[model samples]
Target: MKRPLLTRLLALAAGSLLLSACISQPGPAPRATGDLGLVIERASGSVQLIESTGQSSLARIEGLGDLSHASVVFSRDERYAYVFGRDGGLTKIDLLEQRIDKRVIQGGNSIGGAISQDGRLIAVGNYEPGGVKVFDAQSLELVADIPSTALPDGSRNSRVVGVIDAPGQRFLFALFDTAEIWIADFSQGDTPQITRFEQIGKQPYDDLLTPEGRYYIAGLFGEDGMALLDLWYPERGVQRILDGYGRGQQALPVYKMPHLEGWAIAGNKAFVPAIGQHRVLVMDTERWQQQHAIEVAGQPVFVMARPDARQIWVNFAYPDNHRVQVLDSETYEILADLEPGPGVLHMEFTPRGEQLWLSVRDANEIQVWDPYRLELIKRLPADSPSGIFFTSRAHKTGL
Candidate 1:
């Protein structure tokens, strides 16, 4: 039928309005990921996506294999979290979408992982079958397989520990059974240039890199000292420091190994957990010499410093795990002794050290504290929480 021009224009306008109404509906709100983080639920093999700003859990992602001793590293954008599970499961999670983006079982048992400087590679350190596996950060495909040194008996590979990323696309780790430190340089390509430092110590339990990535220090379990490697001058090899700090005294029973990653450096002094002892070893960072051994509540498991380096927080092993002592960095005095709850497993500070997040496994809670005020601000419930990792670690070295 031939319609009038005014009638045809009105019909077309009505159709346009209908289409616009159907397609232009509002969607979900967009949010930034800078304040986002994850908390590891050790027993359930899951992680809770948490936002630091609101200090609440946004979502829970499950089906991660085993998380008994899980740890996480974030992509450069902080939008993805790479969780290394104790069952050797490497799961890449999409923080914004709140889902597992990819998963791979790369080893028999895994300890931890780290992301490359360019955020392209993800490396996992395996405890069983012993070695490290590097994967493509986006695809979760194997990129490189670095087998740890063979054992003294040539039976199996040595267990790898303390895998951390360095500047220049290099990854550093220690061989537990072989007492060695290795640097895998990948700046060139897929095949890494290996730099091995043998006999660094007896049983290099764990390692840590300086804030600027200048030095790599590995703590020894079979001895009283530690091994230090100056990354700036690799030709000089590893040097032994703090030799015989134990003074050949009968060592106390160690309930748990002290985590070297929790080492604290405040100004010129470095506070390290003295294994099997109830004292925190304060060392002069310049000479790497022991300055003081401040007595603490128990065998210090984690001696961590606040971001401002004003105070240090020390957590203990079992039996005394309920107590956490705060120490003044300058005065080296015990400022506060807090008994938050039983089974305090891990602690993490906010980006600027505004709030401290602690995982109380026995209480099944994540307690947020105002470090300066020394007060508990909030608590979020979880299922056997062990590690509280924040996105701020994405920008830091050796987190």
Candidate 2:
């Protein structure tokens, strides 16, 4: 006559996951998976959790020390969470336990995370050494280390600037400051190797692969334009992107902060953070042409698009104009630039595209903003260098 405890708990978990996917969502359509939730990490090295309806919870982390910039990725099977830290260590978070199950030391400065579509392998960006080290997600064993050099210099140590997984392309792409793209093939059982590593963008900033995974577009802060590299064509392993930063007097500072800090692609547009220029460049992805520049304030540090369909959000590094500027995707105009507080760094929109969560370093708090009204929604107690994610089920939330 009464529901069992296990049945009740399972139902609650499913509901939580669905609600999480829609929390602070930005896009047009609501998530079909209503069991989602959010995971946030602070720069001060703490992690937390948020429910579907914007309820906050405590984040639990284990075996992580001196975490710089880390990323939390949910395994496709939804059994475990693969968390990587700046200390070059990997922690496997068992979903059932909701705590770190094991730790694997990577021995370097880690950046973000990239995993194969199948969730078999993981690739992490190591900055100081400027390389991408691959590991077996299940075993956490060293698979292969893809250095910044595809064609070795034999002299200077190559360093990795950016790394991301291209699902449509089925390969892991890593960007080096020296202007090269390294790909780890995950189609086979063997360890992923550097199949193509050659010069592509001009001192490429962070990179992102198109949804189709045909081309890799990179921001060239060193020059006046961005770089569009032709990937996997094989015949031409690398080509200078049509519209990238061309150095000299004519070249404009495309990014607001250092190296055009906040660059991103939304639908058919490329939003670039012109730090010194105090603006964001909207480029047509199809035409590969510069559309128009939307002006912001201070130094734009990150470009975070509302997880919705219409507007894109931008964040600034400098306190003088630390805010989240929302732009209409259609007209590419600055609709609203809302200031939450001082020192708002990178940010991400909830899967439902309702709220904009920011990692406020100096303020030592994670501020949630109403992307539409441009008002401060709430400020959660968080530290520096933390990460935020959306999920369908209940997980741990850190402070």
**Clashes found in each candidate (C-alpha, N, C closer than 3 A):** 0, 68
Residue-wise C-alpha lDDT for candidate 1, range 341-379, written one tens digit per residue:
999999999888999999999999999999999999999
Model 1 misplacement above 4 A: 1-25, 248-250
Worst 10 residues of 1 by lDDT: 242-251
Show model 2 residue runs off by greater than 4 Å: 1-43, 128-130, 147-156, 175-177, 231-234, 242-267, 392-399
Candidate 1 at residue 305, lDDT? 98
Model 2, position 174: C-alpha lDDT score:
46
On lDDT, the leading prediction is: 1
Candidate 1 residue 40 C-alpha distance from true site, Å: 1.0
CA lDDT of each candidate? 0.93, 0.61
TM-score for all predictions? 0.95, 0.77
Q: Against the true structure, candidate 2 has what lDDT? A: 0.61
